[model samples]
Target chain A: MEDVLKIGGKEIKSRFFVGTGKFPDKAVVRDVLEASAAEVVTVAVRRVDPDSSDENILDHIPERCVLMTNTSGARDAAEAVRIARLAKAAGCGDWIKIEVINDNKYLLPDNKETIKAIEILAEEGFTVLPYMNPDLVDARRMVDAGAAAVMPLGSPIGSNRGFRTEEIVRIMVDEIKVPVIVDAGIGAPSEAARCMEIGADAVLVNTALSAAADPVKMAEAFSKAVEAGRSAYLAGIPERIEEASASSPLTGFLR
Target chain B: MTLKINGKEEILEKEMTLTGLIKDKGLNGRNIVIECNLEIVPRQTWGKVDVKDGDSIEIISFTGGG
Candidate 1:
């Protein structure tokens, strides 16, 4: 296996993280995770049916997989912190994806509130992975605030636009001390591969997988793409030159 | 007894233990977290803790999300 993604003293063999949202059948989530060989899966916290004994999201996930609970509906730092605590108490582990979004129009996360949440959650012994808007300064701030990983959006959440902030994300990949996992706006497997080629530590995907015609096959494709991109990044592509240099010299070739 | 569960008023026959309230609500309390009067009641303590009248309780569970 290649270099695994290490977080909170645990090593994840697969760098591709899958989310458990937007699926037609919730039972298929387990199959997608297995197909993608993903070790970490993200889930949201909400009220369960007090009267219903229907299978919860936890029942579908395999025991081997790590559960990462996200603060999806939180509008501020305090809410995010509370969600994290609840998730931990629910035996969902200490991994919390802090997402503080106030503006529902674009669903863009507030970096300031995210940093605050990361600080509080990290202090509580939670592995805080904050979702930001692909800003370099904010990425640094998140890391300083004790974030386990910095997740920056590629575009908007669930937009499938694919790397709208490529340059900004690249800057984060280059500068941030912790892992820079691209969180949203990835439409295709090619886009995921591109992020890996640019040296992203990992990628979290939901909309594309859930919206695919065959989510299982798409998950496999994404797994391959992520691996290929990581390999290519390790191989190091040669820099491009403006002038075309002839491989065979004219003087050396027989006239 | 009236208990606020997830901000909704639920009238019970009488004041019951937290575990009893959870059972009455059909939750096993295994995969859910409970907060009583702004204090987190651990899963182990649910059986011992009693739900008094006018208590504010919040129960949260893991759902599908990204």
Candidate 2:
């Protein structure tokens, strides 16, 4: 069977979604993307600095990757819609990650606003993926609003806290019709594996890679971890028992 | 004419098209999105559209983010 993630008529081979952010050198993005083999990559739209002539981030991204432009600065749905429109007008693509976050202290996404943005953008024929707090209600609302995927945060954005909402995310994986992408707060490959093991469709990573000592190697590790996790999920992870169960069996030990 | 470009006030010596302004500001040939007065002006129309006074133009491009 072909194991592929399909979103809005697009087939993605790699389940690892990478973000281009906080790299020591912008050039390292290419290497990280190559290592991760991430078919979906996230980017932000910002005003071009008139004073400095900096290289465009698009130049570094491979053409094969689907550019998922995130509305990071939007504090509300209207602003997010504007940013999404601008991103599409920029010729990046129609894929927009509706990230409406007003709470700057914890940087948590506002579910209400994200759903609104998804409603508008998805109506506009853009493939909407909403980054939201891990809540079953909000996830369903987003899906109803035509979101291609519902991205629930594991922890705070860029906190490197690892998977803190495993139970809720697992529930979402079981309930949500769209792909449940565990985005943000995934600090290690093990966490990514855990998310997949719980049946998450995919995981989006950034800080874990950019903040790592070796981003390229870390990207490769995450790639393998996501693959392993998906394979484990497909293979059906055994149910956990509270009491110890001998793998070798009690009667086979010459009893 | 004066325009608010990227939130900065810039005084143009003469009225110019969006393409002219982009060229004058050394922003041509780049993968950028132009928003004039809160409306996205497609790249094809940049040459035909004339930037007026008090126009809030935002030249945007892709950046690193998650």
Candidate 3:
């Protein structure tokens, strides 16, 4: 049987998802996507600058990948809905990541507003994936509101603080019916592996790769780590104990 | 005619359709979504829809983000 992740009736082969941001150059985005083998890539919708004729991000993304346009600039549910509609009207797919952040100091997503947006967008037939703080109540509400996936922040966006919400995320993986994708604040491949080990269905990485010294190489590394972590989860990690247990039996020691 | 584009006021020398405005501004052939007064104007209807004075038009596109 092939190990594939199914989201919104789409069978995704790779558990790794990437974001097109903070890249040293726009040209490198293509290379990074190829290296990471991410089937779902994230992007933000913004007003076109009348002054500069910059290259469109869509041109760099391959046709095979699903474009998950995020409502990053929206400060509330109404704003998020508008952005999603604009993204869909732009001829991008219906996949959307609801990121409604009103608090700029920490850039934390408001669960109430996120839920509101999810309810509205899902009703409109968009595959809604909400990025949120790791709270079980909110996660459950999101699912009820028709979220395709629950993306709990590992830390803060672009902070690269790593898996700070590990315990709650693990609980969400166990309880939530939809896929649990760890997004944001993952600085290293090890953190991605850890998220998988805790039974997350997938992860979305951006700064970890884009801000890396070698983004392409880092993308490859994250890809491997996600795979390795997923495999370990399937393999069933041993239970932890306070008392030490010797790998070699005492009676079997060479005398 | 005066129009608000992307939150900035601009003066159009003559009345034009949404498609005409797009072409005049050199925004043609790019993947863009346009909203007139907070309502989305479908791309197919751009040619038929005429731009009126003081219309708030928002032209948006995809950008890199996480």
Candidate 4:
């Protein structure tokens, strides 16, 4: 998996990036991270109130995982840029998960706004990973706009719907030059594995691990599944066919 | 008095309710769920749920998003 994912000019060791939120406690979060072995962890800036002293998830995450800050609350390009700068100022890191979700419910990124933000962020020299749907044309535009990587969702965020659009994702893997990280709506480990098997460089998980009865174990599960899937993909999966290929087109009349 | 939230101490002028705490901190309550002393703070009770001294408060906010 280390060789599989590269983003922000840095190589990530694992494909499954875990979120630090929703754990029972920091201890549990630590346990889950240790279990999942996620090299990169997705953490949002707005949640940690530095001044208040009551809300910081800083302790829960151990010293090992690389923190990937998010612009989860930003409504537009300007706001996303502002948040990115703030995150940099806050010493969060240069690698940012730019989520330009305007609507509140579905949390879907508005394509127009997200593109604008990605452009600005890229120009500012930030390693931008903009979350996008399974749209290859848009992904091409983003890659040209200087995005470090394009994170196309396998399904809706936290819906755990799995890779319902596997073909489009495969096309994305084929078309894009940068890493194709599958983000959101992953319900189970099998789904995560499937994404990795399909050639996703990495995947981000939150609700599934957070909401689980035992998050640490579940994190470990996601880790193993991703590794296994990646291994399977690398080892080469068997060809699929509706029926047997009887040397029709190329071999025309060999028989 | 110092209030224990996520294992940190904070001094406040008066007893704070979850809603007041949320508003004072300027956090988006919809994206976060608050728990005090291991009890889930219900939406209806968020406004009235009082915080006292030495309460082990935990507030979890979803960050990976949506």
Q: Report the C-alpha lDDT of model 2 over A132-246, residue by residue, as the tens digit.
A: 9999998999999999999999999999999999999999999998999999999999999999999999999999999999999999999999999999999999998899877
lDDT of 4 at A245: 73
Candidate 4, DockQ to 2 decimals?
A: 0.08
- Please say which candidate is ahead in TM-score: 1 or 3: 3
Off by over 4 Å in 1: A51-54, A243-255
Each model's lDDT comes to 0.89, 0.93, 0.94, 0.77
- Taking chain B only, the TM-score of every model is 0.89, 0.90, 0.92, 0.82
lDDT of 1 by residue, A1-255 (tens): 559888889998899999999888889998998899988899998876766655688888888898999999999999999888888988878999999999988899999999999999898899989999999998888988999999999889999999788899899899998999999989899999999999999999999999999999999999999999899988897788999988876586565
lDDT by residue (tens digit), candidate 3, A185-246: 99999999999998999999999999999999999999999999999999999999999998
Chain A TM-scores for all candidates read: 0.95, 0.97, 0.98, 0.89
Candidate with top TM-score is 3
TM-score for each of the candidates: 0.95, 0.97, 0.98, 0.74
Candidate 1 overall lDDT versus native: 0.89
- For model 2, the superposed segments whose C-alpha errors exceed 4 Å read A249-255
All candidates: DockQ? 0.82, 0.90, 0.88, 0.08
Which of the two candidates, 2 or 4, achieves a greater DockQ against the reference? 2
C-alpha RMSD by candidate, in order: 1.8, 1.3, 1.0, 10.4
